[model samples]
Target: NEVFDNLAMFAGYGFNKSHSAAYGMVTYQTAYLKAHHPVHMMAALMTNDADRTERVVRLINETKGMGIEVRPPDVNASSLDFTVAEGAIRFGLGAVKGVGHSAIEGILQARKDGPFLNLYDFCERVDLQKVNKRVVETLVKCGAFDSLADGPLPAGDLEALGHWRGRVDAAVATAFSLGQKKQADRDAGQGSLFDVADGLEAGPVSYPEASPWSDQVLLDAEKQCLGFYVSGHPLDRYEEELGVYATHTTETLERAAEREAVKIGGVVAELKERRSKRNDSRNAFLTFEDRAGQCEVLVFGARYAEFEDLLKKGEPLLVQGSVRIEGDEEPRERKIICDKVQLLLDAREELVNKVTVQLEADSLDEATVCELRDIFKKHQGDCATYLRLRVTLAGQAHFKLPVEYSVRPTDDLLQAVERLFGRGSVSLG
Candidate 1:
């Protein structure tokens, strides 16, 4: 009798009347808000995920899919939390890695006075002890200091701004030092007593000249600061080159059929390694990305062994894989089961048709011709080489001259050509 009563009790069960009604109302309200106020809902969602970086990246991508732009962290406009500005989402400074809560509070407190005029103003105003040089450097690298120098800089303040010739690092360092010295003087009660001119301002500080950082270096620094790419992807410049070798981009995986073979090209963004449970064979799962989006690639067994040497972070690669689907649903996910991989440098030789160097007739001389020949000889391969000359006469005349020898379309050769004739003068078709 007791066993029968226990089975009957399990057979009929229901929630409390009040609890069921409350849950149903809450569910309906949530659904209504998500359906009606998607932007506000996403803003709340992102704000709730402030402490989680990977979640932020995923949400940023989701925001992009919804046609909303997420601007980089800016000192002039950002707040303690993510805020909507000018029809875009502004990244919160608090989300920046290596930036402590104290530093963020200090920045916000300082900005309450007014917008920072320049790098000097920023350094002078903020509590450098909490927001020190390292934190400032990270902010600058992630483009938080960009708005300060956007407009025309004041006269005699170029060195203070450090924006002259892209010497931001040197500029920021000098500004911080000046601010530190000023603070020390104030603390020590060492105000200038001998000054005949009490209100005269100091002259322009001198800053060293430095070339701008290359795109790759800048992007790497951004990734370190923000935990993902914001301004641009590393593979952005190679989009044209990849079109010839890649059958699909990471963004196109949605329409791809499961088990269909496809070729993709991207820079390796992340990699994870594990040992199999059965035989302890090495395997890995990698995340690679192009300008379009990022996708995951699984490398196991012989494939892992074959490409282990090339599977490095930030390396450009072309991968052959089969599409995989998780479920038959409206928002189905697609991943790649990597079968083969090749370095982009190697793919260039097989994909390029010819290297064309465009030059003006006035610039063409015996030395120039000999130098071009030397460059071609250094990278000898099967890709044909050509010279396009623009001659100025009664009317503009163009001449297409073929080189006697073919050369490998290597990156070094392309860079050399660009250096000789300036950028956009070299092309590979």
Candidate 2:
């Protein structure tokens, strides 16, 4: 009995020592690889966790923090797994939702002859039976064919065929129709006169004109197909406002003091509502994402009721909350208890007091000043305007405009000013 008890104890405790040693060695090796080969390691890590969208997003952010760029999926460039391209990590086609292994294989086999020249060329060459319309549309929506769309075209062709998602989508349908006809003829052993005549060719390709998608629309499409934003985040436009108004970022909230009051700004990445177990009160949890990272915000009882309308996915919100850290663990569970919330745009309008336009002395011609005056008049409001003129050797001069010249510093006005003066010319205070 004593011997059996001793053996059982050893089996339970002594075996753990060997297991711990093995784990320790593996941990050390992984840490070493991450420290030295961060890009390669992160690429592998991302590929391994590609099925987990949330984990992939976290890894992508970590890769960026390590000074490694994670490029979007490209049908012409990416393989089935994440690949290293010019010191950056290229996302894999296999990671994209709705693109199956067979579809990727078909795309790869078709591209072996050469890189796809355009959407038409891509559709014509690839086996449409495998790389179907839905697969092609999903790839295009997620920016897999962005390189092809953005590539230089023959002289006047680009202006006539203006490359936008809507145009690309229309072109895809036309290309598929032509491809199907050609395939049908070939299968039937019938040849057209143009096929027999080497000198003859098809006419120029034309795309239907469409208004370009807004940044929000593009991001939404990316999220739909890729499970996350690859090209850009929706909150990117509110960067300046977030910087000025937000007291904490999702990343910085980890170190927030217990029950500390804070203001955070981000788009609602996710929202889940439920009834509280104790009181049967409606409560909700929001996964908020900014440029830095993501955090959870808990809205309970009256707070959920007050902010229910604002807790919508993809909507930018400036949240006033207090941190709630549970336990004293190394990586404790942290969440924000929502106190109040408001639209990010509304917060920006209420907070921004001044707008400054920086101009080079040589660029300040009569035409430029007249355009600036017209812009101010077009957006007339209460925000003060100032012009900083940069002169060679004499230093810059700041001139505040009269109260009548003050204008509303809305996104449209800012965009107009940027379009006229170029980026980095305008600042808000």
Candidate 3:
């Protein structure tokens, strides 16, 4: 009777030899292709599931792991499907949230005629009905129009990019109006009756220079549109502070032995609230992402309540936890059971002892000195501030001078000092 029961169970679960062989062969082929032709394979994978934002984000991380870059969507270069370009995968326009198939077709058709010279040219050519203001905003946020910009942007200048983007966006309506008027005049084969003998030149449309958005603002915009940071992780700004506190990065956490105690810092990328099965108390799961990658953190019961306010999306967090590796998984295979949580800014404040600024002796004018004093006055705090004045003459050494009053060593204060003196001029000890 026991043998009969075992036979029935095997019959219910087993597959034929031919079927097993077919499945194995297909898996082998896929693994072989992925190993040898990662770019092509990833492009196909991305193209196939372009509509699923979460899946696209995961695949994008996978592509990065394979050392393949995923370029932002380009109005001039992108297609309906993800395409291999310059050894990288360019994001498909169809995948962009507000962009639709009609817009993709129109953009492709317009590009076929000639590459768009600028935002004005794009507005003139593409079908506005399909590609509206909302679509343009989304494209700008995701860097689709980057190639069409006036020149190459400085790396690590997302704020500058944001400022420039705001100006360009503010000018879009006027540019579109001018472009449309020109097209209308051409179609009618008649210049405006008041037009000058020399074909009317719409003098270059100019935009008022605007202040740059903060780094967090830029990253938030990226998060809104692309479901992840494409240019750089938000935690990148706090790398130095994180290095001081974190024992392991997300990548290192994965390679660590299970149950190893670790401290990690990252911006909260995702959060889900749940009720515990046993006690019905509120618990939370968070996806924390640093420059290296992301890891999952579990906050249960009392711990969840303690850190609930700090669990905001886009906020940076420092977590003390232990590694929790489950049965093998392909993507995002590591987890953390958080023991303690603190805001990353709070951690920085506790770790940093002093702030230092560097200046050239010759450049320290009376006006500059007043501005420096005002900056210090603006941020009165407990952390001591020091200045290093560089003397250019040979045999004259730089000297350090400590200010009598200490100032608060907040991120805002650091940013303000950096902005006035330029980055790399300010340091925290």
Please give the CA lDDT of all the candidate structures: 0.77, 0.82, 0.78
Q: Write the per-residue lDDT of candidate 1 for residues 346-418, one digit (tens) a residue.
A: 7877788877788888988999888887888888878877777777754445444455568887667876777
Question: Which pairs clash (backbone N, Cα, C closer than 3 Å) in model 2?
Answer: none
User: Once model 3 is optimally superposed onto the true structure by TM-score, how far is the C-alpha of residue 175 displaced, in angstroms?
Assistant: 5.2
| TM, every model | 0.75, 0.89, 0.80
Better of 1 and 2 by TM-score: 2
For model 1, name the residue pairs that clash: none
Q: Per-residue lDDT for 1-429 in model 3, tens only?
A: 999999887877575766789999999999999989999999999888988987888899889988898888888889999999889998888888778898788789878877776787777667666667677777877778767666677766665677767767666677667656765665688665555432244334456566666677767777788787866666766777677768999888867878889999887878999998899999999988777777789988999998888887457888998888787555437789989988887887888877778877887799888888888888887777787777775533443445655787777787777777776777777
Model 2: CA > 4 A from native? 1-14, 150-163, 191-206
- List runs of model 3 lying over 4 Å from the truth: 1-37, 65-67, 172-203, 208-211, 256-260, 277-280, 323-325, 328-334, 358-373, 387-400, 403-405
- What is the Cα-based TM-score of model 2? 0.89
User: Lowest summed-lDDT stretch of 10 residues in model 2?
Assistant: 153-162
Q: Say which candidate scores most in TM-score.
A: 2
**Residue 113, model 1, lDDT:** 82
Candidate achieving higher TM-score, 2 or 3: 2
Any idea what lDDT model 1 has? 0.77
